[model samples]
Target: MSRLRSLGVPAALFAAVVAVALLATLGPSAVERLAVTGLVNLILVIGLYVFVGNSGVWSFGHMSFALVGGYVAGLLALPTRLKGQLLPDAPALVRELTAPPFVAVLVGGSVAAVVAVAVAVPLARISGLSAGLATVSLLIACSVVAAQWQSVTRGQKGLSSIPTSTTLWTALGWVLVALVLAWGYQRSSFGVRLRASKSDEVAAAAAGISVPVQRGIAFVLSAFLTGVGGALFALQLGSINPDVFYLDATFLIITMLVLGGAGSLTGAVTGGVVVSVLAEVLRRVEGGSLFGMDVPARPGLADVVLGVVLVVMLLCRPSGLTGGRELRLTRRGTGRGDPTREPSGRLTPVGAAGGPGEDRS
Candidate 1:
């Protein structure tokens, strides 16, 4: 019974996700769309969590990668005639270039990684709010550029003709990729250094860790994953606009990280699923007429819910939903933490039930 309780949460989550996927595949409605959307968001949030959760820094512009990646993939996937019409003044280079879905997505993610490297070179020098603000500035600046770049992005009109190719199976594959990447990163020496910097930058520097470089690597890697997620999103939606990745989406992703607790990758992914379901439910309720007074749908209820959740999470369990502990289904003991203690307990590599170590990062 104790073992059952210990495994209950993970079991339930797996069952729920499996059930949703099965239903979406068999039954029809908006279930498939919603599942794909949730899965894509999950991928994006988990990617951001790789840096924000582990490094104790915030980045509001992770979505910028998504925007650029989506556009790049969309442009490449689009037919030459369609691209010419939508982006009439596009460069000959752009008009001449086109790729299949798989190749386009790869190029999109690579572009995002290159952009991240460019931004991280300078921005990684700073820490705390400065880093956060730098990323936010990047987000806003990208938003402006995406909104106004009519020749390439179609400005506010957005890009179309993207193929709807990201199905549940494809998204699940990406989810698996995210999990593996995050797990590998968390266990790597690089991840150790980044976490050390997150906990205490001065101490890490004193210990010979290059804080700037690690942070930059995290940024670039996180950007690549986010870009992949965005490319997948574009393939699923078959179109996209700059409005997709903005303050609203940014806040939601951040809220998922914070509410889930920055200490555990599992927590970040779980928070994404939880918040997505909550938002969907709220949207349905808000859109429908209840008893008599129609509860008109407000566009920002998800934000309001996330704000409340953040406050509650901070007050009740500052470490997050996972309390800094991960779900180790193959392990022999409980995978939770003591609430009274700090949430900085060392995490073992996935599939290796090891003990904690000294400050090694």
Candidate 2:
């Protein structure tokens, strides 16, 4: 069946991953910890895919929405007692903003979208490195605010005692949301316009498309999903600090995007899973004991591995692991290109019907 084929690979892969996770969970505490971390990384990578895959833009600020969503949800979902214990002053804001967990998460996502609209509208008007740099600036600005806003974000200490409402199942549900949105966007008219703009911005504008508007819509939607992912991440961890969102985190995302191939939805997903798993594997490898003396694995090992993967991918095949194209198991060109050649809408060449070589009627 069509449905079976559509799910065929993902289903098999999911089963395999679940089995492996079950096995790993029985290991030492570190292995279990790795599973949780990987799940959170999976969510972040999928959110990045929404923008990077469709719009063909490298945005370094996806984590800004993560911060926004995390804080919004944290503020809303944190227990009233904890909020009081942390910051006794803003009872009004806390009272006004209290919400059910899911509702609070949605509100956080919506807030991120609103912010995206304001931030992206102007930036979307530009392209290439300018837009990228502008977004990087946005992320830095967010970090500054998050660090200094002691009352709302609790500054570096961060609001603690968040409820652990996200499980592996819940994370998968979020991934499904991201996958559907990414797939639908990749096939829609707006997606087509966005891709065209990426391919040739001048031609798209000449065709009467509003390039800036299209870019802004994609950028904002991407931010919304990224925000939701952040909320889920906070829920999974049951705590958050501003340090979680930083330049190192941004580079991790970039490395995932570049390693997996930047322009395809599948590539983004694959890149996320691959990098997440690889990081976990490397973490398990503390320098082994030699002659009863232990050599510990230092921090930055994961970064080293990702850096090597990225370099190799860029040098060997810059298009990415998937080559910026979808797998698309269906018949090639079945419903694509030169529709006039088809029986339903066949048309003679412009000159064929009334050219100088035409026979006399």
Candidate 3:
């Protein structure tokens, strides 16, 4: 039973996701699309969790990485003919390169990783709200570049006529891959060291853990995954624009992380699923019908409603839905289910089990 419980967190998440996918098959095409989008959002949230959740730093700028990824993927996936017409002034490499959708996604991740390294070098020195502001600044800078760089980005006109290659199976396959990556990272020493810094920065540093280095590593990995998410987004929409990667999208993605309890991998996945579902419901409400009732169309109502819910959640349950705790299917004899205390009397990656597990930073 303890052995089974050890795998419970990932296993349960896998089952839940599979069940949702199965249900999508029963619905119409629209429902399937929603499922694909939800999967993509989950991937983004997982990326966010890699840095923000484990490192106890809130990043409001990861979407900029997504924007970069989307543009790169969109360009690479565009046909050579269209690229030439769309970006007549672009460099030959930008105008001529063509790759399969999956390959484009991989390239997007690589570029995002490089960008992340550049950002992380400077960002690793800060923490708390300062780091968050720094990231937001990065996002703004990237957005401006996207809007002004006509030769490559088309100056906010963005990419269009890109092939839509992220099907249900493709998205699902990536989702599984993302889950494995995230879970593996969380269970790895890098993630553990980051989380240790999260719990006590001074203590972790005293213990010979290079806090900045760990943070930098997590930041790079997080950006890579987020870039992949961006490519998936472009594939889904069959187009791209600067506006899509700005404030509102950032708010929604961050909300998913906050809502799910950012400390645990389980929280990241749950937050993504729950917030996506809530957003979809709010969208349907905006469509003028809820259940069997006729609702008035209220533009931006979804954001307003979600904002209120977020505030309420912050006031009432800041630790999030799981209270920053992972669900254990069986009580492992070691640590008595405390997520913080490992079998060897060490701290768990995130927090001690049964505690508030709130992020101090």
lDDT tens digits, residues 118-230, model 3?
98998988998999899999999999999999999988788899999988888878877777777667656787788889889999999999999999999999999999999
Give, for candidate 3, the lowest lDDT window spanning 10 residues. 352-361
RMSD of 1: 5.7
lDDT of 1 by residue, 195-259 (tens): 87877899999999999899898888899889988999999999999998888888878787777
How many residue pairs clash (N, CA or C atoms closer than 3 angstroms) in each of the candidate models, in the order given? 1, 0, 6
TM-score versus the correct structure, for each prediction? 0.85, 0.83, 0.90
Q: Which predicted model would earn the best TM-score?
A: 3
On lDDT, the leading prediction is 3
Q: Candidate 2 — what's its lDDT?
A: 0.70
Candidate 2 structure quality by residue, lDDT tens digits, 160-213: 888878766666666666666666565556777777777778898999989888
- Candidate 1 error regions (>4 Å): 1-20, 289-300, 330-361
Worst 10 residues of 2 by lDDT: 350-359
Ranking by lDDT: 3, 1, 2
Better of 1 and 3 by TM-score: 3
